[model samples]
Target: MRLKKRISPHSLRHSYATHCIEAGVNLADLQHFLGHQSILTTTRYTHLTQSNTDSAIVRINALMDSIHVDWGNVK
Candidate 1:
């Protein structure tokens, strides 16, 4: 298979973690799924992809846009 050269047994776990993080799975929960004793270890396993970063920026902008700030009312 074309993937035989690119994939290994250990790499599967890494890929699983990446996909889960990208899918919005909680880090603590993913830590449990991976049987990691420390959240630090889980953090090491997950990575933020471009899509995730973009989605976060969009969410933040949406939240900011929804807020009604009255500069005149500020004391």
Candidate 2:
């Protein structure tokens, strides 16, 4: 019998989230998958690349444009 222990639980969590993000899953979705109570809490658990943020912003802007809505006038 042999036992191996190189990675810890926290490391596994990080690897899981990183892999998921790299696979194109959204952060909000990941937060739910990880059972996080708040998006803020999940934000701390993962790192973001500039490309990811830029792409998200682009998609959000596109969506907003499609809706023909102006957030500035929401109030």
Please, what are the lDDT tens digits per residue for candidate 2 over residues 1-75?
565867889889987987788678899999999999898887777787776789899999998777644676642
Kindly list the per-residue Cα lDDT of model 1 for residues 1-75, writing each as its tens digit.
255467787789988999999988999999999999999998887777898899999999998888776986632
Q: Of the candidates shown, which would achieve the greatest lDDT relative to the real structure?
A: 1
What C-alpha lDDT do the candidate models reach, one value each?
A: 0.88, 0.83
Candidate 1 worst ten-residue window by lDDT: 1-10
lDDT of 1 at 74: 33
Query: What is candidate 1's local distance difference test score?
Result: 0.88
RMSD, candidate 2, Å? 7.1
**Model 1 ranges off by over 4 Å:** 1-6, 72-75
Query: Alpha carbon lDDT of residue 65, candidate 1?
Result: 86
TM-score computed on alpha carbons, candidate 2: 0.54
- Separate clash counts for every candidate: 0, 0
TM-score against truth, every candidate: 0.80, 0.54
